[model samples]
Target: METVRAAERALMARLPEGTLMQRAAAGLAAACADFLGRVYGSRVVLLVGSGDNGGDALYAGARLRRRGAGVTAVLLSPDRAHEGGLAALRRAGGAVIGPERALGAIERADLVVDGVVGIGGKGGLRPDAARLASAAERARAAIVAVDLPSGVDADTGEVSGAAVRADLTVTFGAYKPGLLIDPGREYAGTVRLVGIGLELPPDPVLQALQHEDVARLLPRPGAESDKYRRGVLGVAAGSARYPGAAVLAVSGALRGGAGAVRYVGPAGDAVIARFPETLVSDQGPDHAGRVQAWVVGPGAGDDAATVAKVLGADVPVLLDADGLRLADRDLVRGRTAPTLMTPHAGEAAALLGVRREEVEAARLTSVRELAATYRATVLLKGSTTLVADPGGGPVRVNSTGTGWLATAGSGDVLSGLAGSLLASHLSALDAGSVAAYLHGLAGRLASRGAPIAALDITEHLPDAWRDVVRD
Candidate 1:
């Protein structure tokens, strides 16, 4: 946000005075009106602080006052209020009150515009501002943030102290990194972008994949398509103890656009029983026929040998769960073929030699660092699944997942699906991201607002895939 704001200021200077402010105020006022359905007689409260953010609120409040809404400004810093904006509000018949009176207005407000801090503010809300935020929450009023929700680190999406939880966030020019990521994204509610004509760089540090992006990347069969021609995804998962892991991973692979699935593990019987179509081989990966890619892990028990053998293969490999734990770091780093590592927060933390909380708090940095460390593509799975290549380019963020998708064995399904895509000849980064998108969509469809089993997710992969392609 600092860099963006610097660019904004430079652009503002090049334009006429108050031009940027007017543009921001105009967009903000329109958003406020749209949110507050019948503007006439609506109770609007503005949490005005001491900066350009406050100016935007005061100006928007002035517009609301003219439209027959009773507008009240809660001034946190009366002396530091925007002079023109303050005067404009006064002329438009809006009342100004200090913090003591602010709580009363907030309690009765139909809508609250949070202008307490803009993107530049750090940490969280102060004592007085925090009180207003709390009161507004208790009031259950629809709150629209002027720029960003106060207290969130615009760059890192980290929230340190008390921050405003808004119903809608109206941002100017472009989308900030914080609004698209979690922790901050959860607080932001529904984001509505308000353009004010500030030119930004062509590339962003992070990206979220939409339906079109996924649609274009999905693999398709051709005239020469067959089991081997389409792709053969090898499954080196499961054990005598957890043979169901092999069944689940194989189930995912069958529907993941792969024409064939080869099973090479201790649970060959289990794989054959559940998926009779699988080509079973207990002789391990070397003799598992020709597989384009390998999905190692899930429930391989403590079998480090299988993980090692699969990693040693010249084919692309995806390491998940137990495979992630058993694989040797030096061997993995030395691999010439494409490598993809899918780790939850705990696994990523262990690999980075840090606490899980550290990894969770700064997911962008952790994922990027892990990719560089392994010289491979890294998919950090969480509420927001992220995929990054070894090169420090824009990371792809999956926006399709729900909390219901966190069920047991879900990661196993993801591993098989992604591995299938890898076999079908997509790059490591594309395969991981596409798998996440489809996995999340399937989870949503299977759950339908209820708790879902891992098996349910595998069943819904076809539906998710059809929805993407059909769209």
Candidate 2:
């Protein structure tokens, strides 16, 4: 779904006068009638605002009236309702009334349509409107929003104040950002888009990658593939303090279809102890001997020397955790091969010199900025993990991650899986997103109900792969 703000220019250029409004009203009426089973004899209350949004509600009410439904428009703004729509509603047997009259009628209705605000409006419900909507919330009928649940910012997806708690939100054209993000997302309920004759842009501002997309990107083993032919992933992770991180990373790499995983660091012995299959050596990235890709900084701490050695390598690198902290953007810019950065919100904020809240507010924009700034493919991890390539196109938000995947050391597993895929010769964006989807699916399988350890996530990779390949 693309943000509403991003489509304003195109909408203004193409939408004829009242054309989008009519399309919106028709879609809204259809959805409401479908939900009510039979709109004839059903009572619907329209909470009319002062803009085109109210116009949409009033127009929809006219349609319902023609079908023998009882419709009432509760005008929040006394003299500000859409004039043409208000007259049409009255001509079609719908009554316009004050809040007190509207409240009593709303209590007896089967459904309430909230037209309090629309895409252009910012902040939350006004005090009078908030109280009225709150009362409707306690009523017997379901609350359906006209454009979006009013009071949620269409641009940033943040709630300024109290928003109508809707059972369903019928949006026009593309989706607004507020419909997809956290606090605002909770109040939106199930969102349905109603196309209003707008052409979808070539590259959406934000996109959710589906299962088929991820399945197409998986590595297929060929007949000539050998251990080295498949690819070797060099891991420069772990220290005396956090040896388990290295173990988890190696575990993910081994299970991520990498032909071999070379572990290099002070915690090499610890890594080998957990997984004897991993080739452990104290040698850094340079001496790791012809690795296809390097996975750096999972648990290496703040050691400058080890981080420098890893960064200096000529191979494709997946930088995570401490590697992100130690990065010099200029050096990353000079890398000849592809580079990928995987960071959680906080780490991403630090790398981009912004607050964590800033990264969360405009996640799609922030991820793209991070990708462009570092000239690398950036994987911003969270509930909606986004992968943005530096050159720019649609940003992919992984909709597969489970909340159970929020546990510690889970990111290390992601980095290892992504690094392994990169080593297997996939493009940076494809490798990162594919690893995320598999890791997220594994997290769900590992933690059917209770909490799951990071190591448990490693064992489910094959299951995820099988499901994708089979489908």
Candidate 3:
């Protein structure tokens, strides 16, 4: 938010006063008009506060008033409201009501514009503002938030106390990190970005890779490439108790860019039965034939020795499930080769020695902290999977995952998919991000609204890949 504020300030200094505000108001009004379909005779209510956001709502209300809609501004702080905007609304024949009448106006409105708080305001809404937010929520009107949904942390997606649950969020200039991540993302129903032409920094704090971004990162083998030349992924997963984990992991690895998948575990027979293409070995990862990268810790039960051996390997490794629990912290941090740790909120909570609730509440902080502590790329898996590099540049946020993906053996598939990408020479960050993207898309494709198992996700990986690469 400091970066966005600084950029806003820099842009404001060059332009005339209120130029940015007008631009925002114009876009907001246009979006509202489009949403309403017929602007004439519609009842529009503005929940105006004391910030620039309030002015934006007021100006937009004035625009709607001119279009023959009955506009009403319910000012939370009447005296502190933007003077110019208030005057414009009055000139356009829009009614100005006190907070006392806010609820009734909101209920009667066809559209409710929430400008009670802006990006600058933090924590939660004040008591009076909170009541209005509640009224807007319960109202039969469509709620549209200005700039950002009030009470959501623009920098981190933490929602403390009362926040606006908007049907549509009209954000100006740029997309805030909160809008892209969870908690805040859930609050913001459908985001509509209105470009105000503010020059932002080259390196963003957060990034959400689209299909084109994933397509560019995906590795393609040449005509001359052999199986070994493409990349061989070593799978050190499963045990006598959970041989299915090995089969599922291999399912994902084969679909991933890896040329060959070498299986080294107690599940060798099971692996061979499911995937005859896999090079099965009864030996440990250390004894297993040379491979480009390794995926360890999915259903290995208590195999600490196998986890240690995979960590000692020179190539990149993806640690997940039981492996995340058994692997030594010192060994993981000391490893010279790239290491990617994929942990669900519960596993991450254990590693950080905090409550799982805390990790879920503050995912951004948890992921960054885990990455720094382990000196490895951390992919914190959840409703929104976040991939953060140890050094920290841009934390990639993945929102493509469905609730259907929260099934058994799903993490195993993710581990294998990510490990294969690492073997194909993608950096730890790229591997995690690309794997998450495809894995999420696969979940969506397989489920299609019904329930789906982990195998369904692996089965649809090719469709996800094709969806990304297709023109």
Candidate 4:
């Protein structure tokens, strides 16, 4: 929020008064017109508030009115409304109404512009505003939010109370973090950025990797690359209780661009049965042949010894599932080698000593806190997977996942995939982010709108990889 505010303030200083608002209003009007296929005879309702956001909507409503649409501005605070915007609406033949008549107008309109709150507004909407938001949600009209869906934290993506759920959010300047992360993301149906020429810093608070970004980070084996030269990932996972975990982990590692996967644990037989090519060893990770990186603790039921051994290996280690529980925080913090910790909201809550709901509610804060506490790159897996580096740079957010990924053994595959990337010499941050992108894409491809098993995701890894590096 502060970063956006600072940028807005800097931009507004050089621009003439009302110039920014007009630009934003123009973009909003254009988007609304595009959304309403035939705007000439459509009814548009503006849920105008007291902030500049309200001004943008009012001005947009005026533009719609001039285009032969019946526009009505329902002001929550008539006296506090944007003076210039209100005058423009009045001059353009747009009608004005108070909150008392907002419900009827919203129901009668073909589109509802939610400018009742903006990014600056915190917590939730006021009583009257909430009522209008509720009415807008119940109405048949398509809802459009200006800048951001009201009542969502633009910086954290947290929603405290009643918020506007828009069919489309026409945001100006830049994309807010809330637009990408969920509950807030769920509220913002589809986001459209309207560039108004505000200069932003190169390093943003959050980073979402697209195909080009992931392709650049993906490791490709060179002509001279041997198995060891390409990368070798070590897996110390599973137990007598859950041997499939080891097999799944190795499955993902094999497809994760690693030339070789070395397995060491009680599940060696199962690992070898599934993937005969894997170098299987009954000896612990300590005696396992040299490898570039290690993935520990997927269904590792009570294997604190193995987790500790992998931690001491002096190579990049991906800690997940049971590993996240058994690994020592002091040891994790003391390690000089890069460490990537993958934990779902439940596991993260255990690490942070908080409720799962709290961690889920504030995923950004929780991921950062976990990274700081463990002194490692932390990936908080959920609807929006986040990778936060211990040193506090921009956190990478991946939204490519489907709800079907909640199946068991999914984290195991992710751990192995990320560890393989680590072995390939990507930093913990890059490895985790790239692994998440690929994993999510694989999930989507494998599922294809249906339920899929964990192994299904591994099976589609090649397809996902090809899609990324493809032209």
Per-residue lDDT of candidate 3, residues 254-370 (tens digit): 999989999999999989988899999987887789899999999999999999999999999999999999999999999999999999999999999999988887889999999
Model 2, residue 3: distance off in Å is: 9.1
State the lDDT at 103 in candidate 1. Answer: 81
TM-score for candidate 1, residues paired by index: 0.95
Candidates in order have lDDT scores of 0.91, 0.85, 0.93, 0.93
lDDT of 2 at 299: 87
Query: For each candidate, C-alpha RMSD in Å?
Result: 1.8, 3.6, 1.2, 1.2
Q: Which residues of candidate 2, in runs, are more than 4 Å off?
A: 1-23, 30-44, 61-72, 83-95, 100-111, 133-142, 160-162, 182-184, 448-450
The Cα error of candidate 4 at residue 158, in Å, is 0.9
Question: Once model 1 is optimally superposed onto the true structure by TM-score, how far is the C-alpha of residue 93 displaced, in angstroms?
Answer: 1.3
Error (Å) of candidate 3 at residue 57 is 0.8
Clashes of each: 0, 0, 1, 0
The parts of candidate 1 lying over 4 Å away from their true place are none
Q: Which ten residues in a row have the lowest lDDT in candidate 3?
A: 180-189
Candidate 1: C-alpha RMSD to true structure equals 1.8
Error of 4 at 369 (Å): 0.7
Please, what are the lDDT tens digits per residue for candidate 2 over residues 1-471? 334544644776777677767888999999889888899999999999998889999999999888999999999997999988898899999988998777788889899999989878888799889988888899999888987888877765677688898999998887766677655666788898898866666656566666787788887779998889889999988888998878888888888777999999888888888899888888676677778999988887886677667667877899999888887778887787899999999999998899998887667678889999999999999866889999998777675767889999999999999999999999999899899889998888888877998988998888888887777
